[model samples]
Target: MSVVTGCASCGDERAAGAAFCESCGRTLATGTPPAAGADCPACGTTDAVGADGYCGHCGRLVVRPRDHAETAVATVAAAVTDRGLRHHRNEDAMWLAARDADVDAVVCDGVSASFDPDIASEVAVEAAGRVLASGVPADSPGGLAARVGAAIAVAGAAVAALASTGDPRRAASNPACTIVAACVRGREIGYGWVGDSRAYWIPDEGDAEQLTEDDSWAAHAIGLGIDPRAAAVDPRAHAITAWLGADAGPVEPHTATLRPEQPGLLVLCSDGLWNYLSDPVEFAATVRGAVRKESDLLRAARALTALANERGGADNITVVLVPIN
Candidate 1:
């Protein structure tokens, strides 16, 4: 067992067997325990310490899923969304649904500046995921572009509707979030995005390319002839100009399509994962390395999240991976 030398709250020297500060009654941030202690958070007893990170006394998890979570949609698709090391709670959300050769995925990042941003992300992701999973239009003239556009439109409407009642808590700022949704049907891929969440096509060889353009101030400035590195490192680099919310006038998603020559991986992720590895070449190499280490998409997803955290995860991290067969 590791010892906590001092209580950060009261600056009092900690005594053995004490879980909380004697002076302030504040719980100690004892860091992660190498072994499960006899003290159980739920039952407050020493007889229920389980090695599985759960309370044997009350069947409660000492660690919650909100801290970290993972989902495996299929053998070829998986995703991981994490609260990250610095964030208190995860505001990013992701959904992946696969049917035969079709894979639908959505990732939303809550705008921290807005009220109830987490709610916005959840609402937007769910709305978009539902629409995408409803199946593509087989005979529609719009094809993949129309399908993706429709899903994003529905998601924007869902977010806009949240302000109809106007909760007092959010009077200053309505809930807002950025979205990136995509559908992979056989070899064809269609993607759409609002704000900074991005989609990338990483092949087994050649180069990887970003599919969606960011709807942010920095990206806009770069489009106007600013230096790429200079624009990305500017103070307002992440100030998103487009988002889904009541205050946002309109949610217009930039859409794209890609048909890769070689089968590889399609990565849909929030900025949290790519912020650390913004270089396309480096990002592609890291992704390929992770895949080579673990063929399973679930494991590869975990590896990418782990890499983000290792590089100092300052934001909620979300990643969704779809393997092209």
Candidate 2:
């Protein structure tokens, strides 16, 4: 007697003497077959799905866990990261944690031009977040600013270490990312940054403030007497002047300390969110309005992300919000 070796319905190889194909549960001696490898939602190619959760035939992503992620710590802090509409994968990463009345948050945006940008962002956020959560001693010199700078340095080292002689991709482009982190204790906030990712303080009643200065061409041009509007329109405007990677030399993260007199929100975000609403006043009003309408930090974060997507999501988005009371 001859043995059937394959499923006619799905084109999947059948096990020895199996009655049905495991892939699609099609009968080996089927009377009528449904369809061949119609499982791929993007492309109905027969048995052409890759192990990386992508349609091999059409090269469309199958939507993985990293596509969209969120976290919240009670009502104290919340964070959200999304792949956005145009990107195939999310390269932005964030970390948020609260200890009693203190809060620590970090947000990293991958340099899309570099290799394994996502990995760089993930490593940066984790390393910086751990340092922030560890907290500095009360008697420590330089106080919170010193600790925030140290965390940025640690994250920079972690990202640089990702490059090696073994992997060709790493050797060629090397993984790189931008980082912005903040630590809030009492009424004081200490923040540091290595690239264009930003930190902002939005007060409930008073004016809003952009905390970190971007290390980018547009900022440099504006500093050199060029009009802000003209600089922003330049093709090289968004090109980052500083980054974290093996190729980046002597990363001196910008650091600052803020003591706000009023209660509000401390926002750490990637360029994706700011690109849409860069104005401090408009940004603050939008965030405050979202918080008021949603009445929840997580939902407000989501609403902001949705707003970015609604306004042509050209890149990955990440936002972290810490309520300051």
Candidate 3:
């Protein structure tokens, strides 16, 4: 077992388990263990540990693992809202599920303006998860993107079927949403997306690089030499030219293989989260620091959302982060 050790003089990491750093000669602090009757391991908890090995908070079975790998947890958190200063209900949605040791992960962002945008987004995320678990083809150069596009097509058909139930809103309003998904099989990372919802590769203390671009007029303006900052902030930022839905054409996701040569972080978020980040450097720094702030990926993501809210919370917030260890 590794012991937590920090310098007494400057509160810096010394030798991991040493009483003092060999270089600085500063004393270190040890870690505190969980107290007896601590919260259960599963479901969730805050009350006393239960006698039934079930979480008193949620009554789900709890099991403390003996290995670190077995204990590694992946989670996701999101904050959805209508237009920052207007609108009644939030239509955006997102979820993080690390189904198998980070082998697969999915992040979905629903479009608030569409008919049943929320449902379309949720189904897409779940569908992506199912596709990855089924051993998606990763050998061919563009196979990953093709497979995702195919699966999204299937999900689109399902959405069409659901629409036929005759709720005019779901049937006629034209539901749609953007998505960015990542699947890690062994060390090969397959990612695919369409629309503005983004995927970022953050390796260590480096910058947060956007892996996808928005299919919006502002983006087109940016491409045409208009200042990105000024154009991105223009009031017409809500116009989206691409997304997934029943009427949306054959979904062809932007796909790529990512293998971080150096250990780092990955983030998948909607335009809502990125829109408020005024400075790219600060943006990357804030996201990178998130890794050190929380024990679980999900909590770190939630903290990121809170940071955005604290800054102004001008729009919906959604983020999913994955650490490559």
Candidate 4:
């Protein structure tokens, strides 16, 4: 049997004695045999590296898909997610679906402090996206707010369930994530969120506005009559008060509805983008400038992502844009 070894560069398995890795095409060090007890690349634990390329001690990956990703729906909507310069991996996920005048989108940012946070974000986005795209009846009594709320609940449940598995690490930290979801039908929009992920309405000719209130310490402090500047400077300002996780208690998502009288853009993003442009007016202008410069949804999304990186991407960035005409 040909012995199989993992490529250190890209983490793909390669047959022993192969000159190059088939996955990433990097030259392999086939001549020099691995030391008797090699240290794991991530955690530096002796002889604790697994054949699959993950560190047995720390479970760190050599590489992963979605380090950067882009998706589009004709010219109507687009989304981008990137690992950014600081993070070891991309822990943000987004989903976009558009049909005619209807669109459904979701964005989730993993809690870095939690184990397997990437999985939590991925599952939350998928669950919320599916619910948003379920084609809730137009004449339904509960209407879009209820639909959006239900999507958040489903996403929260999905993230919470990650702790139910046998992994003690998962139970300890309990994979967690923040979610923001939006659904657009004709000229009306419905949105909801948990944690700091945000949704903004940027009109073509008027002031822009943030649709969802953040469930974070800063916002709570501001509500309690603390000065905005004082609240923002606090170390706990960005610390989320609500999230999707087994330990997050009840997931009471904040939801709202919007009916724009003029043409605009609906923006959904993780903190990576907003951290640099928290002002609604600046965020709207930047997005508008990108759309005008690129004249394409996918390219505009990419431009926004590039701008975030240029500004020192301290966290995973995710941006989703849906044009409302």
Candidate 5:
């Protein structure tokens, strides 16, 4: 099988599975990730800002550690990095933490081409998380759809408003980004995403399959009869047709709930991390090893990043690891 290699952020082709691009220390095939943001969980009413990793209201830590007695231990790990191999600075950003999995998560990949792309990503992640936390109104079929539609429109509008504002990161044109968020509560799971960043759930015991498809030009080409292998090789594969921001053309998204109960590990990541670690078996092995090392959830996040970095830190890699028992 062909391996994954090259600078996902810059699109430099190289050896398959090669660690870092010889041209640059940048881990190839890995894309830029969103940066961490303030925790704005809806359920977290405590004065503790969820973003600070604690409960301001209760004056207690917000992130609950692994307590054998408190339900099954749910482990979450993640890391974000940007070296700006070519650019003056890295604009990618990411948020990975337990904001009440039941409440869901928010991930946004901003467009580096635009000014303050990082801020755009931050705005998107926070908006999605807050919306997911706020209770969706009680609705029937039409009501539910209409409510969701309105919420999405409002999200777009909110993003636009930020673009107009003069935040240090904001510019005449707002950066574009792609976001994917998933909510897991017990056996029930709901997911939503705008742009191409993805969400994947691979059973700890069963098979590994990607739950989301890329919204990239190459992915679209594959749907039109081109071979995925050839499509992958296309130089234009790097060209993302959609995302969030001023340059982002439209705002279409994917939303759904899992059928039958899903019991396994939940993986959410930016294109950077997924590009190099696409194999389901390998992905599972990495997570399992991290847990076995007696490492906490945070360690689990570091272990994976370490692996990528060891291989040759290529691109900005970011991941959220959630263990569902």
Candidate 6:
């Protein structure tokens, strides 16, 4: 008998039942399927999140720690990372923590074409998350935006510093990844991004808005004059123009802030999830439906990932959902 296995992040071949993708450094599955009918953490309802980890009543994702790996900082914030159907492993990572009235979250996607991209993603998120958790700098002149930018700088440096640790091939190819992060305080939110990962403001009663613009070929073409639909279909559409790695030039991070009129969700995600539902209105509706049903932020994040998988799951998916009530 012969078996063939391919990476979930990249289409590289791998040994059967491998624990990690050799091409991308993403974690592989042991062939065990995820469990279903888990209880909803918010409503104490069984099978609320369903087999896919999404709650029907609240439309949130109840983490089934058994079925797949997931994490949550509090009722207000949650994140989920998964290796989709086509990928053998997940090359994405996220970190989030709620501190009093403030919330910090980071999401990173490993560049499939780069060496040890998974390592770059993991390191970047850790460095950024740590900076966010450490509290804002009091002496800093720029405040939240500056702090967010600083976090991205720290993340970039961390990735760049890793170039010397591995083999020569690693230094040559250089692990690379895209990152998006946010620090929210009450009604005010500060966000930053490098590469194509994204952040959005999803309101409870209004239209959703994409906060950070993508740093990719498609976005650049759209800026010049190309129609969005046309630009997105190009061969270089998803190719990230900026990232954190040894080869990446000076990291030109983008920063922004917003204050919503009503309560909503502050969402951060990788291309894997957004590619399936790019329309802000449609994405917001899907999220609003889930949040209304479960009121559990974690379940909401999981539901988003599930939606991506249902839409072909061509790559690893990651999402962080934080309630802004």
Candidate 5 lDDT, tens digit per residue, 71-115? 112343333333312233334444332333332444566666677
Off by over 4 Å in 4: 1-62
How well does model 2 score by local distance difference test?
A: 0.81
Least accurate stretch of 10 residues (summed lDDT) in model 4?
25-34
Question: Which regions of candidate 3 fall more than 4 Å away from where they truly are?
Answer: 1-90, 95-100, 140-143, 160-162
lDDT of each: 0.77, 0.81, 0.57, 0.81, 0.54, 0.76
Q: TM-score: which candidate is best? A: 2
lDDT for position 181 in model 3: 72
lDDT tens digits, residue span 212-296, model 2:
8999999999999999999999999999999999889999999888888889899999999999998888999999999999999
lDDT of 1 by residue, 234-286 (tens): 99998999999989996678887787889989999999999988888898998
List the candidate 5 regions with Cα displacement exceeding 4 Å. 1-90, 95-103, 137-155, 166-173, 259-262, 293-295
lDDT of 6 by residue, 1-325 (tens): 0012554334457633564444433333322233466666668777665656567788775443322446565565777778777765567877655645567778899998988777788789878866776656633687777788889999999998888885888888888999999988888888999998999888877678999889999999999999999998899898888999989989978987787889888889999988888888887888788777877876777787888889899988888888788
Q: Is candidate 1 or candidate 4 better by lDDT?
A: 4
Clashing pairs in 2: none
Q: Give the TM-score of candidate 2.
A: 0.84
lDDT of 3 by residue, 117-186 (tens): 6667656755654555455566654666555555555555655455666788787777777777776554
Cα lDDT for residue 241, candidate 4? 95
lDDT of 4 by residue, 181-211 (tens): 9888899898899999999999989999999
Ranking of all predicted structures according to TM-score, beginning with the best and ending with the worst = 2, 4, 1, 6, 3, 5
